[model samples]
Each structure stands twice: as structure tokens, then as C-alpha cells.
Target chain A: MKNASSFCLLLVSLITPSLWPIIGHADGVFAFSPEQAIHVRTLAASCAACHGTQGNAMVKEGGNTSEENNPVLAGRTREDLLSKLLGFRDGTRKATIMHQHSRGLSLEEIDLLATHFSMQIRVIRPPLSPQKLEAEHG
Target chain B: MAEPFNRRAFIKAIGATGLVLASRPSLAMASKPPMGRVVIVGGGYAGATAAKYLRLWSLGAIEVVLVEANRQFVSCPMSNLVLGGSKSINDLTFGYEALQANHGVIFRHDTVTAIDAAAKHITMLGGTLSYDRLIVAPGVDFNYQEWPMLASLDAQKQVPHAWKAGWQTVNLRQQLETMADGGVFVMNVPKAPYRCPPGPYERACQVASYFKQHKAKSKVIVLDANAEIISKKGLFAKVFNETYAGIIDYRPDNAISHINLATKTVSTEFDSVKADVLNFIPPQRAGKIAQEAGLTEKDYPWCDVNFLTYESKLVPDVYVLGDSVAAGLPKSAHMATNQAKVCASAIVQLMSGSLPDVAPVFANTCYSFINDHAAMHVANVYRYDAGKKMMVSAEGGGVSISPNEKEAGYAHAWANNIWADTLS
Candidate 1:
């Protein structure tokens, strides 16, 4: 399997640049190794379905964007996020769904998630506009 | 017996390898690495989420093309509210503009006619697209073998399924609106492993809520093929028995044996029911595209996948997601998006010559509204089980004790956040 992988790598190097676009200059560089960054990003995205992408949770129209509305986790201090996650895991922090989620995660994973969200840059994005239903919908 | 990897599969796998090694030298020079294109079919929750995350996690390094038949996204999650009159299809509809604008994902509003897996190219109505990796997330297609009479589009117009949350949803809502006060609204629940286990029950509640508000004399007859409720049993049972006691007639283990469209009647082994508005949600399998691509097994309707990467067990370089995947987990929108994220992560890692997370963990949260402003949820965290080679439910995961208004607030917030997360 190892030999096959290396062979595949060699073939990829010879073929991919011809099929795909090459960067003119190095851009969108990663600080962490490619694998580590992808692992953490995938984990963080699991929370995105409810918490907005990168923990910038969106609120209802005309609703306040405070902690009351699914509280934004991005750009917070690491200590604050870690303490809250630990509290949720330990049953100290009361939550409707967080407790259920936090209890299943390992302590190490919770700490990692806290650090992941803390590093994200929070931006107050405009809420997406809902499209009208078509007269003849499929 | 391992099937030999085709030349197309080898090329894709190598493309992934190129993404890794090419970037290493580029990183040393403080530049970005070159990456290959990924073509995703069916832009529902699974495909759309995959497209967005592939671009997001790859930081615009990878080219992602999303091919969808529809112009807008109609959510199957909150779509039940459309039947109860609490929300409109418009409120649940969204365009792909955000995904294209924010994530730089290429959007193609065209239907895929055929997928040549061995060639790594798709033949669509408009044109052909080649890719290094293919993600097929076509949700579900209703099975009509048993009731061949209801297979036609015209038949669906009268006895609608409304399962996909589009034209059928509108048709069903209109049928209910025009129904007399004393009319009977009959709907059936397909057997287990259908899309959204709690969905049929929630639809019954929505129809009942609508009837209770406008037509006091109307009745809702729920004919479930399963022996009992498959999801949120305690909560759904309580709501059916107590809240809509007189309005809802809950019948279990009553599989449909025959349908008489002219008579507006459905027959089981021992019973025959006629209704003013008939909702027939037939048993389902993977979408036709997956079936055509030879993704599903000979006996099973769903495509088997490695839960870690959601890569097809049958085909190399072809990943399956959403309701199309055969799994023990509930086929909910949240589960589909989570699977998409995991698949996207694996693809990114694979392209860069690194191994995917061996112990991938994720959560699935599903909210079912009992009414316009009251809801309940079932949530769980699942981790990859090495022995089973699939995701298994972890500890501390279950359903809500009861339906309440607070969850309703969270439910709407969930819709907004997930939409933004998926599209923007």
C-alpha cells in the first residue's frame, strides 16, 4: 500500500498541473500542516449547520446578535470558550443541545474546538435573502 | 475481490497526490499550491455543503463545480411548516448565488444525464464536465414498483407524495385548502430507512394543525407501514394522542397493498381507506443518477460508503453522501451536511497526499415542529468505530423530553444558520 501511494504521488505530480490551474504566486498559505488544518476545519464545520460557518451564528431578522441568539464563538478568548465547553461537558453549564454534544466529545477535542473557534475572524455577515417560490416548481 | 482501479481512478488519486507534494515546495516559497477540480452532482444539503466547504477549507485552491437541476434550494427540513400555513415555500427557498459569490464555487443549473465513472466525466444536458473527484449526493427517489399506476406525473398531481418539498408540497397544500371542513386527509408513512424518520409524523402534525385551525370537523388518518414510530416515539406519540387526540387517527403496521386512484381509496391487508386528500409517500431508494452510475448494490437501494470519507465502496474516486448513502444513521439534513464536511475534508487531505482523520467525530441534530411555534429535537454525536468501519452513536445522545417554544426559536435559528453555512 505504501509503495502504491508513492507511485500514485509521482503520477499526480506529472499530471495534475496540466489539468488544473497553477497559482501565479503563492497565496492562501496554511500555517498548520495541510492534514492538520483540514482535520480541524472539518471538525469545526460540523458545528456550522447550527452555528454559522466558523461559529458566527446568525440570528432571526430584527433579533439581537448577542449571546442570547446562539452566541457567536468566533474571535472569543480561548479561556472563555474552553471554560464554557468544559462546563457544558461537566453538566455545570445549562444548555438545550450543547450538553448533549459536549458530553460526547473528549476533553482534548473540546480544547481543540475552543482553540479552533478562537482563531477564526468573526464577521457580521448579512442574512441571506430567501428566494420566492416559482409558480411551477419541480 | 477488489475491483481493479480504472485509469480514471488512478488519475484522480494521483491528482490528489499532486495537490500535496506540489504545495510542499510552494509553502516553502510562501505560495499556494495548485489543485484539481471536483465535480459535485445534486446541489441539495449534501452537495451544496460539500461545494462550499471544499472551497472554504481549501482556501480557493481547489476548483469546485456544483451541478444541480433546480435553480433554487427548497429545504426538506422546514418544508413541513409550509403545509401547516406557518411558512411559505418562498420562506424556505434559496438561490445558489451566495455559494457562487462567497465561496467561488462554479454553479451549473443543469441536469446530469449520465456519469461515465471509468472516464471521470459527466454528460449533462448542457455539456460535459471532467473532474479529479466526483461527489454524488442525489438525495432520494421514490419507489413506485408496487403502485405502478401512481408512477406518472399526472397521477402524482392528484395523489401527491410531497416528499421532496416542491411542486408536490404546493399541490398538497392546495388540496388541503380546498378540502371541506368534514373531509378526511389520509397520508401514509413508508417503511423504515426513509428520508427523515421523524418527517412523516411531523407532516401529520402539520396537516392536523392546519385542519384544527381552519376545519374543525376535518380528520387526519396516519397509516404507518412500520409497526411503530421509528423516531422520537415517545414525543410524537404524546403529541398524537393528547394534543390532536380527536383529529389524528394513528394506525401502525398498516402497509398499503393496493391503491384505487379513481375511487380515491387505499387498501391494506385488512382495511380500505378513502380520503378527500390522499398523500402517498412511497418507499424510496437512491436517486436515479446513483442507480445509473452503478453505485447501489444489487440487493440494496442505497450506496454503501466508508463513513470516514463517504467514498463509495463500489467505485473508486466516487464519493456518495446524504440520503443516497446506506447507513444506520437517520437521513436528516444535519446528517447529510456533516457527511459532506467529512467527505470534503477527506478529499482535501487526499489531494495533498495525507491520510484523512482516522477517528472522525460529528454530531446530528434534527428538530421537528409539533406546531407553528413549538418543536422538539433528537440529537446525537457519532464517532468512527474502527471495528465496524462505520460511524457509531456515542454516549449522551437522545431526543427531547417534550415539545416546547424554546426549541422552536432554536429551530428557526438552525434554518437560518445552516442556510448561511451551506450557501454563503
Candidate 2:
């Protein structure tokens, strides 16, 4: 038993040296905790409705806002979205439509929504080609 | 051989102890008593950024307190567009929630009355607060005396500086709105070493462009105090000529000597000009608090600091940053934010008994929106020289010229990025 335990200990020490640093380093970068992740997920549902699954796409038919005016939010950094959201929430960002929507969110909700949207993949459609526009016109 | 315990039991005990020891480091970190308090004055880009970074690098070890006179901060970064009627004041305003929630910084919405540097305490309207380190970034205070006629508070009612964000900007916009077609709008730029050197010119361009579009007959006259305008000179001048050719009359080296508010005219070194609206941005010094703390020279309202560490030369454990420090950098929001980060890191190192390495990279980018679609940007990377005790720009660091009108539009986009980088 003693010899088997010694062998297991040796194996564990060897494995940990390689894997521990990566996990420890990753842990150090998290500014949020596990509870905060749950809060963010709940807050991101409103955005998910228009932005589509995980903020991946814009609603093609239901988006009444002009494309030139509305900014797509997928793939933006957490800090960027938080700042804009907070600005809108506080009435500092000043959008006619977004101001009201942002105001409805609590500060914690804003933070959560920001975190969730920030984690999604950004998908940007290419600018409409003139050729495509011409074909549609015809 | 005799073993004190069974091999399995001994091995399990060791593993549990190792896990405990590994967790102990974080526990030890959490148990450390919070160190000396830091009081940061001003909630603008400089003070706010300093407070956030200080808390960040301290790793929850230091107490940070921010004293701002106003409840909210309205950025001057793109206030010119407000004058052009392109953007609203709401677009420029930002709250202090992010710094408070994310960074654990205490915010005090009160004016700082005095700085008792000898005692390392600051007196605000509410009460006196002590600090282990005090960072002053109260921004610029205009010298109304430079224009004798408009020197008094009553005279300010007639001619507006609109330098500080918010109400002043709104007033200036309202004045522009009421002016008649074919009316003359006069703007005077003070001498060098003023806050946001390119600001007055950008304001002129925006106002002139607006006039050209809405009231083509109205003219905007810019009177410069210096021999040459400092930033984005070629691009701005080219756009001025091509787009609003006759609307903007620019005169360089024409300093305003006096103003007659009753007569509604200005006396410049070149000549006297009468106008419907007069905008004067006077030479400015650091806020009065900086002067009282002995952080400023005569006529200068800022302290001299090691640009790398932002530590004061005259005082210990006190740092001066942003527009209040006589750091050889452009007094832009971007520069202030960068300087704050450097200062925060250095402060952390100082508290930890660790010597910081020299020569940190401080960078700044200033974007000027000539029109709604056109803009220009100047960015530079700077380093501190130990021998000279000064912050100097690295060679090949300067403004990037906009390729064409289309590219200039990116300047407006750059404004969004810059604002996000600093306040967000």
C-alpha cells in the first residue's frame, strides 16, 4: 500500500506542475464571480430578443429602427458595452429609444447584460454591394 | 522500516494540506488591513481614471476616495459638435457608477476648499479628510483678468468661455442659435500652453461649417494669439478653404488686448472687430487647490512631478496628475487617463516596498472633428528621461494626416473610441 501511494503522489505532482499554472493564471483574470455570471445571464434576455441567440444576429424583419442609426452589439468588449449601457441608463448617452430601454434595467442587470453580450461572437454582415442593389431594383 | 501512519492516510493528509496551503495565499491576501487612504480631487477624465486604476492595481489593499465638485462629468472631448448643432449635451455626459461599483472607490460630491498639505489633509465643504496620498487633477481655471473688460463675474454674463462642460456649452450654443444670418461670430484663441490646444480651432471649424450650411451669409472670424495654430493645421485650413471658403476669416498672430462689452467689440493687436457673438477662451492655470498646496509655481496652477511616477517634487506621498501637473504632455482626456494608469501602478509598487522600473510608456491621441463627416487625429508615445527629469515624445510620434474626406470621417468614429477608452 505504501509503495502504491508513493507512486500515485509522484504521478499527481508531475501532472499538477504543468496544469496548475494555466488554471491559476486564468482564475486571476476574472473580475467577476460565479454569482455575477448568473446575474448577467438573466439580464441578457431582453437583448437576446432583438440581437438573436447570444447576441449573434440582428432581427431582420422586426428591427424597425434604421440600420444607419442602430449599432449592433455582438462581440463588443464588456467594458465598452457597460459604459454605453450605463450612459444610456443614466440618461447621459441620450438616445430617444435606447434611453428608455436602458433606464428600465437595474445597475446589476446592466452589468450582467454587458457581460453576457460581451461573451458572444460578433457577426457583421458585409455592406450591401451595388450589384446586389441593382439586381433587387430590377 | 516503520511508518507513522498507513500510506493511504499519509498521502491523503499531504494532499489536503497542499490544497489548504494553496488556498492560504488568497486568504492571506484578503486578510491584509487596508492601507493608507488616497483622496483624488476632480471627477474628469484625469481624477476618475486615477481613482479607478489606483483601486485596480492595489488589489483591494488601498482605500480610495474621489472628491468631485459636480454630481456628473460632461466631457469636453467633443463638445464642439454641440456648438455645430450636430450633437447634444446629453451625448457627452457620463456618470460615476462604473468607478464606484467595479473599482470600490468612494465618491464625494463636494467642492474641495483647501489642501492642508503639511497635515496631508484636504478640506471640503462637508468636512476635512486625511490621505496617505492625494492626487490633484482639478483641471484648468480660466484667467478672466486677461480680458479686462470681461474680467469680472458680471462681464462673463456677456462673453462666454464655455470651457468647462455643461451649462457653459449650452449657453454658447444658444447664443449661436439666436444670431442673425450674415451676422459675424468672433472666436479668440489664447496663447500656447492652454488646455486642449486644438479645441478652439475645432470649435471654430464646427461653428463655421454650421454657418456655411444653414446661414451661408454669416461669417466666422477666428483671431489667433500665436504665430501658428498648433494641431491639424494643414488639414483644417484646407477644409476651411475648400468647404467654407468665404465663411471663415482666419487671422494668425492677432492677440486680443481688450474687449468692450458695452460696445460689443474686441480690440486685438491687429485691429478692433465688432460682432454679434463673442467667444473668448482665455489663458488658464491649474485650479486654485493646486496653487494652495504649493504644487504650483507663480502664475502656474500645477505641481512639478516625476512624469513617470507622478509623485510631487515638493511634497512626499502626494501625486499630481492630469491638467493640474506641469507634465510636458498635451492636456487631452486621453493623456490624462494614460498618466493616471502609470501613476496608479507606481503608487502600488511604492506601497509594496517594490522599486518600479523606469521609463513607462505614456500615450495620447487627440481627435478633432472638422465637420460631421471629417476629422483628424494626433497621437504620440512619450517616455520620461531620468537625466532631464522630463517627459519627452519619442521620435516619429505625431499626428496622422487623414487621407481624404472619407477617411476624415473616421475622426468622428475615433471620438467614440476615445470616449469609451477614457470614461467607460
Off by over 4 Å in 1: A1-37, A64-68, B1-33
What digit string (tens of lDDT, one per residue) describes model 2 on residues A30-75?
3444445423432342232223324553323442334321355777
* Interface RMSD of structure candidate 2 (Å): 19.4
Residue pairs clashing in model 1 are A26-B31, A26-B32, A27-B32, B16-B351, B20-B352
Tens-digit lDDT track of model 1 for B102-185: 566778888998988898988888888888999999999899998899999999999999999888898899999999999999
Error of 1 at B203 (Å): 0.6
lDDT of 1 at B239: 99
Output the TM-score of candidate 2: 0.71
The candidate that wins on DockQ is 1
Output the number of the lDDT-best candidate.
1
lDDT of 2 by residue, B105-136 (tens): 77777888888788888888888888888898
All candidates: DockQ: 0.41, 0.02
The superposed Cα distance between candidate 1 and the true structure at residue A34, in angstroms, equals 6.9
